[model samples]
Target: MSSHDVHDEHLPAHRSETTPATEPIADPGLPAHQWRPTDVDPAAEKRAERQVATMFGLSAVCTVLFVVSYFVFEIGEVTTTIAGLGASTVALGTTLAGALLFIGIGIIQWARKLMSDHEIVEMRHPAASSDADRAETVAAFNTGLEESGIGRRPLVRNSLLGAIGVLALPVPVVLLRDLGPLPGDTLKSTIWEPDMRVVRDVTGTPIRPADLEVGDLVNAEPAALFETDEEGEPLVEGVELQVEKAKGAVILVRIEPDDITPGPGRDDWGVDGILCYSKICTHVGCPISLYERTTHHVLCPCHQSTFDLADAAKVVFGPAARPLPQLPLAVDSEGYLVAQRDFDEPVGPSFWERDSR
Candidate 1:
């Protein structure tokens, strides 16, 4: 009978009979170890080495191709459609995927065929170990290293190192492309120009100062966006036109002329207390429309960023990092409100290494 069965047999039969409980038994040693096919067969080991080396070699080639693709294709080129996809996109994606795939395959192959594949069974040890236990652990680690044969396999080791080293090359090169041409003066300017009348967004109707009440807030855009050429065709259309309109979007608010406070060098910028500011939030580019007439605060629904329109659109509360960019305003000869010029500074969030001017 097993020890557990024997212990159970020795239990007291009657409730009146008192007896002490037996202590828990200790664990027995581990089962016998087993060897793997690669450990016993030289042919299998050699085949595994070749397979791993091939994977590493393929990975190295993919890395080289990634670098080549960086220069070969223009970024926006949209030719060579495969299911309506660009050739540059396909080449770069496939090469990069192959680079990662081969390296993963190589490591898996090495672990399955070349690295130590012995089945070891370890006995349960105490939670806290003694000096002897530490020594035994170190000895086992050394034995495992020897069994792996990494020291003897120079070809596999060097090839893997080379593949991994080459893999690093594409990373820096890709990042270099990001570090290329910056926005420069693009951020500092918008579609707003001098004498361009302020038009209502979407309807494209020119806004006169009389159209707005004291507490009214109207979403406005540059009048130039709605302009038609001599042929009666839209000067700007499609994505390009949409982008320009979005960046140039503004909010027109009319308050008591005495309530408006024009900043330094901006005395004549407003028309009859009708001040205008970029609708795009300076915090993170959310379209702001919420207006509190009593406070003169325009609140961005995203991030709850509040800008005091009464005080040059200064950041009064919330996560906004900077004040909203105000557009210089004036009245045209026809009584329609117009922009004096574009914004004095950039209208969006600060970016890496960006110069605001």
Candidate 2:
């Protein structure tokens, strides 16, 4: 006999005599199944199927409207507003939400009202199922497919398929517009023309060499933004002005003449001991102003990229691949600091077309 049979043979028959006898609990079987209205009545079943198909049809219609609104709405102009939201945003959001909502409702209704509802008991078993259990599982799946009625209910099946197919059309259409037009030479240059005064950022007052002392770091901007603001007709306005300001923003810092180390061909780029460099970080374009006066190091708070401003803003500590772009500086007849010309290279993050390292 097997080892299990041998172990059972050792058990004493007199053990039952010493043990107290107890009555075994009887099994309580599953409750009686109840038939749904749709299962009993053919008319109710037909009605449920139609309801499901209608939901899917509505989903397809909303998906079509979503595509329509994407092209019809003119962005940024804000021609119409509804309860503080733009009409374009309202239409696009509503239509897209409707499409997803209807599809979800249709699937739920299909399972509840028209699909199989028979109950079956699943007993506890080993973690690894037996071959017989696997066969039963396959059979149960096939039974579910039959009871779901996808073949019998042509209208519901066709509408659901069509709704899902049309939903994908909006993705490619949105992507085409989102790619936008080519950037051309816009990224390579800023509004920093020759003789453009380097003024204080918010105050817009021109910066004279005397305004800075050793170890002083001042945030500055191109004077062209505020010059026309005083004239009442700004040279750049709205989004254009915002874009120019971001690219043209700079930091003016003065170090001791003995501590300055100018890059090749940039010896005269500083006025007295004051040097100018782009305020935008080369790594992902985060604005950097956190400066350490003692080491002449500027740190980008977003990613901790450190640059030594006294040494041509070279990356000394973190993930930045290159040095900050330096602004060639000069002094006008009024003795105020000005740009000799635009930045020789791009100011912000590196891109596909530029050699950044």
Candidate 3:
């Protein structure tokens, strides 16, 4: 090796590490803190306190008015009009809304004006704690609890509790209103009568035997479901009747007469080649309308529960446990279709206590 190479190996290869230049660094501290007007001026502080208190005071008054309005306005009463809304609705809505809004404004004002406004910086240490550190934390928590003085200041605590307790009253009161009268036996019968003519649902035209071709499916309702009584009174109307008809709905289908295998007592039910069955799926009450005429099977779109219309509407496929209910069909003197009577059994999805007999 050359002498230069030998000398270079003996010398320390460059500096082992690089150190930043050690000069005294200047500290850039936080900017000067500005005091609020309320903190410096006694008059401003008093005014701000009054403003917050006024907001809270108004909120209390509105809460009282909410209670009053609950009784004052009858729910459906029609009185003076403001922009086409009833005066009671407007008053109740505004007063109740103001009650909540004013309280929120009051809390915001209190925090802005009166609550401690000092900025604090906390230095975080490692999350894992030693016994000594935990003891110190507990001591600090006790000191904070003592300083908060919540137990001694009953006015604020009591008022807060009162407001919260009063707010809970309406929840139970509204729930009690839901426990009112229920419809009994109303769901068991529809507007159908002994000789009511069967009609198409929307067009309201009477369904005649000739109107249905082979394999044709028709959605029909009892004529009484749409008729007025002799005294011009509607046989059924409103929610009670609607729910009844939904469970008693029927569908009429016309197939070849020789295709049918009637249930034990339903031989005389169909008129000519026409047969009728309930529209509701016995499994989950979905309207079963998808028909396969060649197979004589009607499929429920919901769960694919297929029923054999040719054999007493028996369950032929899918999850349904029972057959669809059959409606007896007859023709009136005018050659329009009519129901023999109300369904012999209840219609709709089977319940736990349902009796199929």
Among these predicted structures, which one has the highest lDDT?
2
Residue 97 C-alpha lDDT in model 1: 88
The 10-residue segment of model 1 with minimum total lDDT is: 73-82
Across 236-285, the per-residue lDDT of candidate 1 in tens digits comes to 88766887887899999998889877777878878888999999997778
lDDT of each: 0.84, 0.89, 0.75
Residues 1-357, candidate 3: write the lDDT tens digits.
Answer: 999998866877455356568998788666678788877898986787667656656666666776676567664434666687776668767776776787778667756765556665668888999898899889978865564433543444455455545545763464365474333443345556676788887666899899999999988776656777999987777765576567667788888999989998999999987998889898888997889999989999999999999899999899998888877888889998888887776677776656544
- Candidate 1 CA-lDDT value: 0.84
What pairs collide in candidate 2?
none
Give the C-alpha lDDT of model 2. Answer: 0.89
Sort every candidate by TM-score, greatest first.
1, 2, 3
lDDT measured at residue 19 in model 2 versus the true structure, 0 to 100? 67
lDDT of 2 by residue, 136-236 (tens): 89998999889999999998899999998888777466647677534456668999999999999999999899989899999999998886655588778
Q: Give the runs in model 2 whose Cα sits over 4 Å from its true position.
A: 1-54, 75-78, 81-85, 120-186, 229-237
Return the clash pairs for model 1, or none. none
How do all models score by TM-score?
0.74, 0.71, 0.55
Where does the lowest 10-residue lDDT sum fall in candidate 2? 175-184
Evaluated against the true structure, the overall lDDT of model 3 is 0.75
Off by over 4 Å in 3: 1-83, 87-92, 95-186, 225-249, 256-268, 280-287, 302-306, 310-325, 344-357
